[model samples]
Target: MSLIVRVAARGDGITADGRHAASAAPGDTLTDTGEVIPGPHHQPPPCRHFPECGGCQLQHLDDDSYAAFVADRIATALAAQGIEADLRPTALSPPRTRRRATLHAEGGLIGFTEQASHRIVDMRECHVLHPALFVLVGPLRALVQRLRPKGRVELHLTLADQGVDLLVKATLPPGLAAAEAITAFAQAHALARLSIDEGYGPEARWEPQPVTVTLGGTPVALPSAAFLQATAEGEAALVAAVREATAGAATVADLFAGLGTFALALPAKVYAAEGARDAHLALKAASAQRPLFTEHRDLFRRPLTVAELDRFDAIVLDPPRAGAREQIAKIEAAKTPRLAYVSCNPSSFARDAKALCEGGWRLDWVQPVGQFRWSTHVELAARFSR
Candidate 1:
C-alpha cells in the first residue's frame, strides 16, 4: 500500500516550489505539485515535467542558481577531500538547444517514459530540443501514431550540420508494414532524414545518413553516434573555457579526448588519448595539426602510469562519470607539473581533485560550465598546478 504525504510548506534543504525529501507517511499519497519553479542562480524550467522526470532534476532551478549549485557541488566534493580552490560559474546555454535525444516510444506512439515509471508520457512540446525539432514534432507524432508497433520504441534524433537524423526502434507485430508507411510518412512530411530499427521487421536496416552542425559558423561534422554537447551555446562556452585553461601551455595531453574537441583549438601540442575507435577516427579527421601522437587505450581499464606522465608537461583529462581514479593515482605518483581536469560528474571529480591536492598539486580554479541545461548535470573544468 502507498502512503500520501503532504508537504509541510518549505523548510531546510527544501524549495518554495514544494520540492522535498521523500519520507514515509501513514496513508496519504504524495501530491505532485506541477513542475518545480527554479530558485535563484538556477536554470529555468524548460519542460513542463520539471523535477518529476528522471531526465532533468535541476529544471526548476533558474540559470544563475543552477550554475551556483554546480560550482558549489564541486566545491563541496573537493572540500570533503581537503582540496580548496576558487570555483567560477561558467555560462549557461539558451533553452531548447538539444541537438540529439533518444526518446522512448511504445505502442506505436512516440513519448518519453514517466518519472521513475516504465509507463510512457505522450510529450507534446519538448522545450529542450532544437527549434527544427519543434517544427517536426506534429508530423513525427502523426507518423508514429500511424505505425503502432506492439511494444516499446526508441526514437533517436540528431541535428547535424546539414539536416536532422531520425532513428526509430521498435518491435513489430507479425504483419505490420512499417517501412513503407514510415517512408511515405517521412516523404510526405518532408522529414530531413528518417531511419528505422525494427529489431524484427522486414525493413530492419533503415538508417539515416549523418550530417554536420555548424557551431558559431564553424562547420563541425560528427558521426551520429559520436558524443556531442547537449547545447550549442554551452559547447561554445566550454570550448572557450578549455582554451582559457590550456592557454600558453607548450605541451599538453588530452586524456579521453573525444573527437579532439579541445585538442583542435589548443595552442599546445596535444597528445590525444581516446578509447573509442570511432572517436579516434573522428579526431583524426577533425584535427588539423596532427597531435604528437594519438593512442587507442582505455584509460579506465589500463590507466596511464607515472612513467607516462613524465612525457607531458601538462595534462587535461575528461573522463566519463566513473571518474579517473587510476589515472589520477598515476599522475600523482608521477608528480606531473600541471593538470587540468574536465569532468561531468561532480562527486567523482571531487574525489579525484582531493587526491591531486594531497599529492601537492594546488587547485587553481574550478570553472563550472552549464553544458546540459535544465538538468542536474554539470560540466566542470578544474585547473591544478604543481
Candidate 2:
C-alpha cells in the first residue's frame, strides 16, 4: 500500500533509487517500500519533479557543497599517484553561456529529452543558453512546425559573433518541402550562417567553415568542426590559468595548440602545432606580424624529437579528450624539463600527469575551472617541473 505522506523535503516529496517514497516526510521509514527514505528537506531541489528531471541534481546543494564534490574527486585521483595538490574553488560562467545545443527535431517540431526519459520536453526557452539563442527558440520552433521535416533532425544552434549559426541534419520528405523556407527564416531572423546536412554514413554532409568568435575584443576564428571550449569566459579563464602556470618562461612549445589560444596569450616565443589545416591557418593569421610564429602540422603522428625539444625551454599541451599520450611519450623520451597540461577530462589528465611525474617531473599545482556548470564535468590546468 502506498501512502501520500509528506516528504521532509522543503515542500515536495522525495524519490530514492528510482522508487517514490511512500511518505513525503524526511527520515521516514515505509515498510511497504522496505527502505529508509531521507526526508525531502535533507535533499536538494525541493521541487516535486527533481528526481524526475535530470536537469539539476545539485539544486538542493549549495555552491560550497558542490565545490567539495569536485575537490574530493580531484584530490582522490591525485593522492592515488602520491601527488599532493590543492583543488581550488570552482569558477562558473555567467548564466546562458551554453551557445550551442542539439535538440531533437521530430515531425518538424524540435524538443529536448526529459530528465531521465527519452520523452521529449518541448522547450521554447532554455535558461542556460545565451540570450541570442534563447530568443531564437520560439521562432525556430515555429519554423520547424511549419516545415514538419520528415525524419528526426539534429538541430545545432550556435552563438556566432556576427549572428547565430543554425545547422540542421535531417532528411526532408516531398510535399513538406521547407529547405529554402528554413534558410529564409534564419535570414529573416538575422542569423549569421545556416548550414544543412543531407548525406548518410561516415561521410556525412557537414560544413567546414570557420567558427568566428570575438574573444578579449579580438576576432578569434577556428574550424567550426574542430574542438572548441563551450563558453567564452570559460575559454578566457583557461587561457588566463595557462598563462599563470607558464609565466616567466623563456621558450615554450604549445602542442595541439588549437588556434594558439595559449600561445598567443603568452609572451614567450612559441612553437605551435595543430592537427588541422584550418586551425593552423587561423593560428598563423592571428600570430602574423608578431614575433611568434607557428608550423602547420600534426603533433602526434610525428612528435618533436629530443633535439627538436631542445629548442624550447618548456611545453604546454591542450590536447583533445583522448589526451596527448603520444606527445607525452615523446617528451618522456626527450626528458623535457618543465610542462603545463590543460585538460577537460580529469581521468585523462591524471594519467598524463602520472606519466610526466614518472619521467622526472613533479606536480607543482592544479587549478580547477568549473567551465561547464550544472554538469558533472571539470576542466583543469596542471603545472609540472622536472
Candidate 3:
C-alpha cells in the first residue's frame, strides 16, 4: 500500500511512492490495483454523482484537507515563479453556497457535464448550488423535456436581489407554443428575469421588473451573462482582503471592475473601468452622487498607461482568468504606491506577481479563496507595496 501525500491540480492525489490515484485524498492509502482506501483526510462525498460530475472534483476530501489543497495550489504556482509571500489560511465557502452556475441540459437530463466528457450527469441532488438555484433544476429538466430542445440547451442561473435570473440558450428559436410554455415556467417559478438566446442575442420573454445584484451594499443592474463571484461568503472574503490591501487610500482605480464590485465597496473616490457596455452603463446609472466613477475601457487591448496608473493612490485589479498581462506590465512600470490584486488563476497571478516583485514592488501577502468549493479552481487576493 502507498500513502497519498498531497493532491494535484487536476484533483488526483499523489502517493508517496510516485503513484497517482483518482478520487484519493491526502492521508488516504492506495492499493496495488489502484483501489483507494479512505484515510483520515477522506470524507464520504455528499453528492451521489461523486467522481462523475464535473461541477466538483475534490468532494472526497474533508474540509481541512480541502483548505490545505487550496493553499497548496497557490503556493505551488507561486513557487514555480520563484515568488513568495505570506500565504494566509484559505477561506472556504460552505456547501449550497454557489449563487451562480451554468448547467447543461440535453434530452431529459439537466446537470453539469461528466468529468472530461460530453455526457451529462443528470443531477438529482446537488450540494454546491444555492438552494434558490438548485430548486429550479428539476423544473428545468421537465421544461426542457417538454420543449424537446433539438440537441443541447444551456441554463445559466443567478440568484439576484429580486429572485432567480435565468438565461436559456437553445439550438433553435423557440416557436410560439414553446415560447408560451417557457413563459409559463418563468411565471410559475417567479423568476426575476427570463431571457432566451436562440442563435441570436438574448431576448427577454418575461421580465416584470429589472434584475439587480447587490454588491457591497449597492444594487447594480444584473446583465444577462454578467460575471459574479461564485459565492457571497467568498465575495465577502475577497472584498475584505482587497479593503485591507488598499486601506486608507483616498483615490483608487478599479481595473476590470464588473458592475463596481470593489469600486462601490471602497469608501474613497473610485475610477471603475470595465469593458462590457451593459456593465459600464449599469454602473454609471448606479453611481449617481457616489464618489465612484465609471469608464468603458477594455484593459486587454488598451491598458492604462503608466502615467494614468500613477494618478491613483492605490489600484484594485480583478482581471479575467487569463490574467492582466498587458495591464500588469504597465502597473509594474508605474509609480503606484500600493495595489490589491484579486486573481482567479494562480499561475497567471504568480506570473504577474513575479513581474511586480522584479520591478521593485514588495509582495506583501496573499489570501487564498476557495469559492469553487471541493474543486481544484482556486482564487486569491494579494497585496503589493513599494
The residue-by-residue lDDT of candidate 1 on 203-281, one tens digit each, is 3233344355543333445654457777777667676767776677888888988766677667778788999887777
Model 2 lDDT per residue over 183-218, tens place: 568668877667666655212123235447654344
**Model number with the top TM-score:** 3
Candidate 1 CA-lDDT value = 0.66
Q: Report the poorest 10 consecutive residues by lDDT, candidate 1.
A: 3-12
Candidate 2 stretches greater than 4 Å from native: 1-57, 114-119, 173-177, 200-211
Q: Write the per-residue lDDT of candidate 3 for residues 268-379, one digit (tens) a residue.
A: 9999999999999999988997998889999999999999999999999999999999999999999989999999999999999999999999999999999998989999
What ordering of candidates by lDDT runs from best to worst?
A: 3, 1, 2
Instruction: Name model 3 segments beyond 4 Å from true.
Output: 172-174
Q: Global lDDT for candidate 2? A: 0.66
Given candidate 1, what's the lDDT at residue 62? Answer: 50
